[model samples]
Target: MKRRIAREKAVQILFQLDVAEVQLPDAIDMVMEDSTGESTEFLLSLVHGTLENLPAIDAEIQKYLRNWKLDRIANVDRSVLRLAFYELMFDEATPDRVVLNEAVELAKLFSDEQSYKFINGVLSAYLQAGATTTES
Candidate 1:
């Protein structure tokens, strides 16, 4: 449930980014002001870091997205991909399986039924494609 909370908060923060374009610290303070949880920092870091490196992250996602662009994807699905893809690509402390699983769960909660399968497939492909390049 810790990851679930983190994922939910991350989604909200990512969604907020589209409208406000505020800095992460300010955004984090705003988000945390109303919410209480153990996973808040983790979510904030994930959301902020991912936003910082979104160009690279979206490039990676685009590499595996076939025909889908980040802008073309639904907000919830895009947020899930951004968080999971960031962790999978950049966060050495988090395991690939954990990122993929958490992303699928987030998709299930925030997106349509088909989104769960789509997210799983995209992330699975991402892991498979990335596995060879990872030194860790």
Candidate 2:
């Protein structure tokens, strides 16, 4: 089974980073400490690595977002995209489908009903196109 709770906690921490303007590393420390699970390390890795690669991740998001700018995306949807994109792009340990599915689920939990379909469409298009990036 998935460590859904840990993923949920990471999603919350990511949300805090945007709304609360909390430093990413500090948010990771707080979230990692509070989140209990065998998957804590994986969750922490996702948060930190995604934060580290946020610029590139956002670039990818922008490529797929069509008319919307990155900043225009809801904070919850943006964070969910960052997490899922990080996993899909960098974390070979996580399957692409799992990353996309978990992101959709998280978006549904944190965002409006429209968020689920939006995230699903973006991630699906991303996957279908093989997630090629011009960035290093």
Candidate 3:
């Protein structure tokens, strides 16, 4: 699957995981129920990698938040942030620019109208602040 599509699916799966308290595999299955193919490897990796590295990702995000706790962010916005950070942190082949853009796009599509701006702000600040990843 294309990275954008895979990323979108990752957000969906992650949202289910967060909101429904669903297990990773089950959340993935629920999100992929409409797919013609089984979950693509890229999709699986994004979801798995994000979840595997979640504690680290959330901690990193907390550093960038001003007044808002991570949990207080809208669920879809949180999912987009996590997926994009997963790509930024671990998927080195994709540039941070692409990750940021895709994240904003996903937020626009799945989150409330104002959410994309918030997503963009946090990500841009993180990048400008010299974002570090586990792999870095």
Candidate 4:
């Protein structure tokens, strides 16, 4: 599967985990029910890494929120941000622009109409601030 597909699946699983409080493994299993491929590895990595480092990821996102609180952000938007932020911080092989674009795409697909703009702004701010995984 394409990375975009993996990302979309990751967002679904994350959303499920967030709303239903499903266990991480079960969430992954739910999303990967009909899939079988290397793409699943990437999806698993994304979900596990995001959840494992959720606090740090949330804090990173919180810093980029100009007037908005992290909690005030929509769950779908938050999950999108978390996945993108994880890539920015941990997956250095992918360029920042790709990460940002993919994240915006995810927001456009899974979130409310204005969510993509909000996600773009926050991610742009984070890039401008020159943050790295080590910093926060």
User: Compared to the true structure, candidate 2 yields what TM-score?
Assistant: 0.85
Alpha-carbon error at 34 in model 1, in Å?
A: 4.0
Candidate 3 Cα deviation (angstroms), residue 38:
5.7
Order by lDDT, highest first:
4, 3, 2, 1
* Pairs of colliding residues, candidate 4: none
Off by over 4 Å in 3: none
Against the true structure, candidate 1 reaches a TM-score of 0.83
Write candidate 1's Cα lDDT for 6-93 as tens digits: 7778876786676567876776677677675444667767887788788888888888887887788887788888888888877888
Of models 1 and 4, which has the larger lDDT?
4
List pairs with backbone clashes in candidate 3. none
List clash counts for every candidate, in order.
Answer: 0, 0, 0, 0
Score residue 84 of candidate 3 by CA lDDT. Answer: 85
* Per-prediction TM-score: 0.83, 0.85, 0.93, 0.91
Question: Please, what are the lDDT tens digits per residue for candidate 3 over residues 1-136?
Answer: 6778888888988898888867877877777788866549898888888988999899888888889999999999999999888888888888889899999999989987789999999999999988745573
lDDT of 2 at 7: 76
Error of 3 at 106 (Å): 0.1
- Top lDDT prediction, candidate number: 4
What is the per-residue lDDT of model 4 for residues 1-136, given as tens digits with 9 covering 90 to 100? 7899999999999889888968878888888888865557787888888888899888888988989998888989988999999999887878899999999999999876699999999999899888744532
User: Global lDDT for candidate 1?
Assistant: 0.78
Candidate 3 displacement at residue 54 in angstroms: 0.5
lDDT (Cα, tens digit) per residue for candidate 2, span 67-114: 788899898898888888888887777788888889889988989889
